[model samples]
Target: MLVSKKIPWVIKYRPRKIDELVNQDDAKALVKAWLRSWESGKPEKKAALFYGPPGSGKTSMVEAICREYGYQLVEMNASDYRRASDIERVAKVASLQKGLFASKRLILLDEVDGVSGVADEGAIEAILDLIETTKNPVVMTANDPWDVRLRPVRDKSLLVEFKRLTKTEVLNLLKKICLNEKLICDEEALKFIAEKSEGDLRSAINDLEAVAEGAGKITLDLVKQILRARDRVLEPFEVVRNILRSNYVWQAKQNASQTDLAPDELMQWINENLPLQITDPEDLWRAYEALSKADVYMGRIVKSGSWDLLAYATELMSAGVALSIVNDVKSKYRWVKYQFPSKIRLMTQTKEARALRDTIAELIGRQVHASKQKVINYVLPYVRIIFDNNPEMAAKIAVGLNLTDSMVRYLTQRNADAVLNYVRELRKAISEEVKASKPSKTSSGTSPPTKGKGKSTQTKEKEGRGLDAFFKKT
Candidate 1:
């Protein structure tokens, strides 16, 4: 047995008159007056523009007007024709040619705003000129009317603004169509489509078409699938919630790493949300302490270029952290709001200033043959002055040292600024420290300054050298 495709009720029985159209009662009344003027042997505005959000029935209005006034329609999107000659051809045909059966002609321009730039400019200008003097009743539709380029058209035509359809109007229309077509869809499914449409009837119809095509009846699951296709990637919060709600530590770990977040961001999400999930304060502290150790491992991995360490770090933060929790019962948790890490934000702004300061400090430490730490303590104050003038140098140092935004700010010693200033200061301090600690540099340059006594200088310098040697050994 064969079956014929079922036509949707919305399309099978579209309105043919202004009075029959759903919503836009005011626009219908205004269109009615225009029709009456033509009926009584008087010419109203020869051209009118319909401006509104998509699927608000601008095209439908034009067709209704034609049916009411006994006029044949000539419709086209302005974007399709690229040349001035093409538009002129259309204008000539519409103006000179008689309607196939009716006495009058109705020209409908869809998406008139799309006509623009080098290719369509001539064609668009021609159309506007056609509107100014054309004999037919012209109806133009566009999303926006305040576009400065459309100002001339506004001067030449009457503009009617159509609003987005209300929820009640969309619901009523959907209900009417469903009844007429004998389609069986749950109220929730229909309402879901209507809300998702955002007042766009075409979108609603398309959704209806898809659902009907899949099965005779539409279900809520189908609607959810269609609506949420773009959100496939697992969210970190969902992962954490599932983990905290689970009974087994290994299961929780597996669930947490299933999300799209990397180890670092994942750590922050866990840190912020873990306390809310664990009821016991002692358990929460233990979990946090384990996470902190995992973070230390993560830092080591980054510095030493050892990727094998990531698994250990991840395990510590996930399974280890979860085990630290005393209870494993599932329950609701207060949502942790996402926030930018202050340190990261600062790095972005003051990277350059920080780098330069670090470079200079490293060089000074090398020259003195002393420890990087001693050089930083003694030389950073002087280098900070450079930040007042050379912020980029300071920022560069900050980047090299991996200073957080707050640390950057602390380095600059200025609280009232774009936070970038702080980043620059910190970068300089860190880079200088790294350079001073290099293997080739002697311990003498990094040594600390002494008191008024020459003995103090010698003693501090020797202590600085000892510190540098210790760091090198580590």
Candidate 2:
């Protein structure tokens, strides 16, 4: 019986040492320095944050380092340690205690930036706290370090950036893998795969494995075929051009299905360029009408979790939108450059602002004991007004809520320096007030026991009325 080789090429050929990692010398050096510091009993930085594009050797490098140095790795992905309690249970325990067999422990939080919203409440703060007190070293990896959610974590950890692998480097790695696998691969085939991978070495290797899985030999033609079939393979512009110019419904549908663009994404591209392609106003209206119907189908699919409706959504968006153009004005469509969807562009531009808004909403919900929706709809507008009218009150609220500088600036639409100064002043004042409220020591240098102070009945009623008035403005 011929036993199958089950090990995936990507995993089987993973780098085993620091020197084995490609195009990430700086990252390797930083990680080595961090490890050496631990040996000296004084770490320069307790945590190292690795940020880069995917398929780079961030995770592999950390794992290799831990292996080489005989450190126990307590690894957890974002999904596993999403909540603060989860982090405390796993990471906190790992950090506070010694390893079973290894000399030292390394807490590896992979894709640290993936933690988000309600699920990740207190996660960043928890990580920051861990880095401060953990006897073991902590390491984190993220695709985007500048993510607003990661700002606190970024500040606490030392940042190590991993650059994308060069095309030549990727090509060389593929050749080596092919040689080891004993698959006869042509130079042009390997080069094509490397160029198409766009500096993602892992993807290049996976693609090579896929093409050479059962084939006796790899050729340039096989590489080209695989590249063409890759998902979302068609450029948005070309897909839009074909959808607009094609007369046959089947041809338009085939074009839509062949390319990797999802139905909704294809619709956006078509919607953006349809008017520019079709000169007639009636055709434009009809095209938009088809798109609207397609969106209705999409809504149903989302609500019902029924993927069967996807066919209808695709047909309506593709052929239905294409058929709306009755006039044979192919000549006019040639000169127009396809315009990208403005909505997507706007969303990309305001991503950070939106994240800040959601953060503020969550904070308000916790403080007011209201749902997030209620806080956003009924309370946030008034809070903005209050911030504008009373800076001191706004500063106090910000401090009370533990709002970050970025959050405050985004919500108040103020300068960064101004927000930072205001927050600092408010924090100082709050600290002083707390100091004053504490009982003083007697002549013997011992404080006297006193009755605990609680909110008075009248004070509670007055506060209730104040909140009532606040909501009335909203």
For 85-153, candidate 1 gives per-residue lDDT tens digits of 877888657866778888888888776664432123576577777876676777788876776666777
lDDT leader = 2
Q: In model 2, which residue pairs have backbone atoms overlapping below 3 Å? A: 232-260
lDDT score, candidate 1: 0.67
After superposition, which runs of candidate 2 have C-alpha atoms over 4 Å from their true positions?
1-4, 116-118, 230-474
Taking every candidate in turn, the Cα RMSD to the unseen true structure, in Å, is 22.8, 30.3
Best by TM-score: 2
RMSD of 2: 30.3
